[model samples]
Target: MDALSRAGPRARRAAAAPGPGPSPLPWGRFAAWIDCVCVVTFDLELGQAMELVYPHDFRLTEKEKTSICYLSFPDSYSGGLGDTQFSFRLRQSGGPRTSPFQDDGRYNREAPLTLQREAAHYFGYVYFRQVKDSSMRRGYFQKSLVLVSRLPYVNLFQSLLQLIAPEYFDKLEPCLEAVCNEIDQWPPPVPGQTLNLPVMGVVIQVRIPSRVDKPGSSPVKQFNQENLLPAPLVLPSVHELDLFRCFQPVLIHIQMLWELMLLGEPMVVMAPSPTVSSEMVLALTSVLAPLRYCCDFRPYFTIHDSEFKEYTTRTQAPPNIVVGVTNPFFIKTLQHWPHILRVGELRMSGDLPKQVKVKKLAKLKTLDTKPGIYTSYKTFLHKDKSLIKRLLKGIQRKRPSEVQSALLRRHLLELTQSFIIPLEHYIASLMPLQRAITPWKNPPQIRPFCQEDFMKTLEHAGPQLTCVLKGDWLGLYRRFFKSPNFDGWFRQRHREMTHKLEALHLEAICEADIVAWMKDKSEVEIVDLVLKLREKLVRARCQHVPVREETLQRVGLYIDTIIGSLPEDLQAVLHHP
Candidate 1:
């Protein structure tokens, strides 16, 4: 038979995981095909074998090595006694066996066989089938085909290992074997059993000595000390970050890892989450820890943060491992944080790293803005200062003194004074970070978040004035058009859009600076400047969104022209100057 005919389908051992055999290869396959047993084998390459799962620490002892498998042979290898040019040989249980191809031409040729084995404490069992050739040919009687037991896909590696002699396997076909002196069982269950629990674990770093929170546990290195800076510190490896960027959202995969590694067995992880550099701690400790197996222990962070949470709920992960980060200190210093070192057992490193801390920046000065805020054209979006103050005061009334620390009191005061405080202020530190992204009535006072709302709220902002110039937009226009993530099968356009918007914001800030400089000037100068700026604003906004710059510019110029076409600013009865 040619090489193509020699290849066979994978074999799931009927002896170990016994189930009704697959119905005879549908109607297309004929009786003649079952006469020749061609055992197609896939031997596991050294590295590839690591992927096959086994109990933890299964290879600790040499005598404990019982069964090993490399190929999944189809059931067609049971018969076909033939006198071909070569003999059939294979490495099986106990030892190797070599025999000539049989030419019996009868007696059921194929034996839908699998190259799998079992073990107890010590002994191993393997099955090697070699049919003796009955053909009257003289020398052809001793030829054989050897089967290597392992997974398929070894074509490349096997070529490199050609120098290594191939072994012929033989089946033990043992009797009721019993363990004696930790070495007797010939055929029994493997060393480990499947687990049925949660798989949340920690990769200990800086192993918090048992002495922590005690007299002299030892202090972790802090950056505050001037003279102690060490050699160039590498960026905290974001190895786990890839998990958050996978197809499965990071959180779901994390919970799944808990289920697979810590839960029941005879199962496998088919889909993992996409990975993200920012979510490293969450990926390893919480996401992939449960997927670890003693037989095949490979740790990978494939889950993406964007999709991870779609699969999890309250009970999916441990309640203690909050998915969100609410710590104000952590939020303020997000960029400076190093690799997230798992602080506790729960995968809650989304907050801050172990050594890093958020230091509150002292307020330089608070600008009093009662009159400007109340009278601003965009006054509608601004909350009533009195109402905000009253609400915060009410919250403060019942809280413990500690909860209302000086910092908290100051922040609450800012809220009361009609200032939009960041939503992070309201959240508890232990809570997840996702809450900040959620929509709420009070609304988060985050920077670009507020700006996003302000732009959309035309009526509330009351004739919002904008000053933009083509020159103000340098890299922004180039970036938006250069982005390839939009049309070519985009998986995450939302994030891209956000990035584009942020680029545009810098343009707004530059425009604001130019307009701020001309706030006070000659009427005619201001009017022309306003017209030009309005033209730019309209153009910029229309370029990105649906609105047109021509239309808004025309409207702004018409309004300003009409107003400029009016008398002077009738000051409060010309306050005696």
Candidate 2:
């Protein structure tokens, strides 16, 4: 099949941009959410393969194609098979130096520069379908329909796929064309605003929360009370931050999981399907939200992934990453990983799924173990059984899914914030007093973090103080200091504090009477001071040290004024630039 040459110009143009920029197609709108639509089929000769990329002419590097193929289909996908849906991420190596989506005016356009520098990843939503086919060699036809996007709106994408995939599987290319055309009509994602996305005759209303908005504050559109509609308007439950759905079965061990996430411990999640594996991984990564996870994570990993060897190697300690896989091979391959959570298929038992009990295994027994958490790390904090009980009771009372999800979200958010509060307070104390600053000398360095001293303060100000949940937070903090997560958090806080001090120093220098200082020095000395000030300004701008705009302009005016008063040769040398 000539897959590459089948698409027309519009399809090619829509999927062209790798990151976030305007599509060349004459659709006078930003490339909304869907980046590209792909159809991956299992080929008898080539194994997992891409049957067609909707934008057939859109070029994918061989490496990219390999990644898409493996991630789209589950490995060791045998036994009882039905349709399954999951998500994956792909890290692109390069993009525009500046924010590419600035013109798009989306709230999430400003991606973190540091994370972007490391590797800017995008999301892939895959719907895998298998059907009995006697004509096929494998006795089944297995394929996946994928939608790529820079945004991580899992629910919206999944909903889109529900409408598109089944039709596309039956009708083929023509269905994809109709879907893409429908997507073209979608309004650009505005932060904190409800979006009514109409796709294939269905209006899916959703709110994409802004980073500034508190978690779970996203409002749902309301239907008029006077209109006695035959059917009730029900908003889809948001799963983007749905930690409850993933952890409900294993809620008793969530404290330990939170600690592991905080320490950036390497873990492997084994599940029965790609959907469960991906959801669990995504949920675990967000266990310590508000404080970035600062480590690598893959939702649905496969044996054929590029980093498969890097992740599975037993030569040394495992890298800080959370790998989710369905293939039984990982059970043995990732046995050496510090923590492993093996979960069974998600069961619908009303309020919660069947609680997956934590088994304190003498050894991982990687060769054989039931579906449960297998980890040696003892949890420092006590489990808040009251919270779980309340949730269960609410479920028993038949609370709506939205209500249950909100309750879970609030509990977790508070839990995370309570843990982080003491750290924030202590870090604030480390900053140097403003009175200690001197115009003639350098800014004072921040006091180093003392673990023992900070631990002592926890008695009064720890998470237990403000939060209903109680724990041996002191022990958690002591262990935390030795973790990569603490180091990353400390370094980030330290750098930000250091930047503030430097900005203060620059302001002090700018405010000093440079004109008077020049009076006391020889011509050469005056020239040297002028040059140093200029260099400092350039350095501050380049480093993004957050100096005030007015301060920068004032320094520039001073430099020009000082240089004008210098000897003609000195003035010419300074003005040459």
* Candidate that would win on TM-score: 2
lDDT of 2 by residue, 379-491 (tens): 87888888788778876787766576677767777887888889999999999897787655668989989988888888788887778766677777778788878888889
Off by over 4 Å in 2: 1-36, 54-59, 79-82, 90-120, 133-140, 174-208, 215-241, 347-353, 362-368, 435-442, 502-514, 536-548
TM-score of 2: 0.81
lDDT of 1 by residue, 1-577 (tens): 8544453321211122222332233211111111111222232232112122111212222211211222111112224443211111112333332222122221111110111121111111112223453552321222222212121111211221121112222311111010010111011111111111100111111111121122212234223233323322211111112222221222212222232222211111111110121122223322322111122111111122222233233334221121222122222322222111112112224431112121222321123211000100111122234433433453346543333232222332332222111212221222223334321112133333333343234333312222111121212212312322112212222333443343343233333434344456566664554445454455445444333455445545444444444346622222121
The estimated TM-scores of all candidates read: 0.15, 0.81
Error of 2 at 525 (Å): 4.5
Worst lDDT 10-window in candidate 2: 110-119
lDDT of each: 0.24, 0.74
* TM-score of model 1 vs. true structure: 0.15
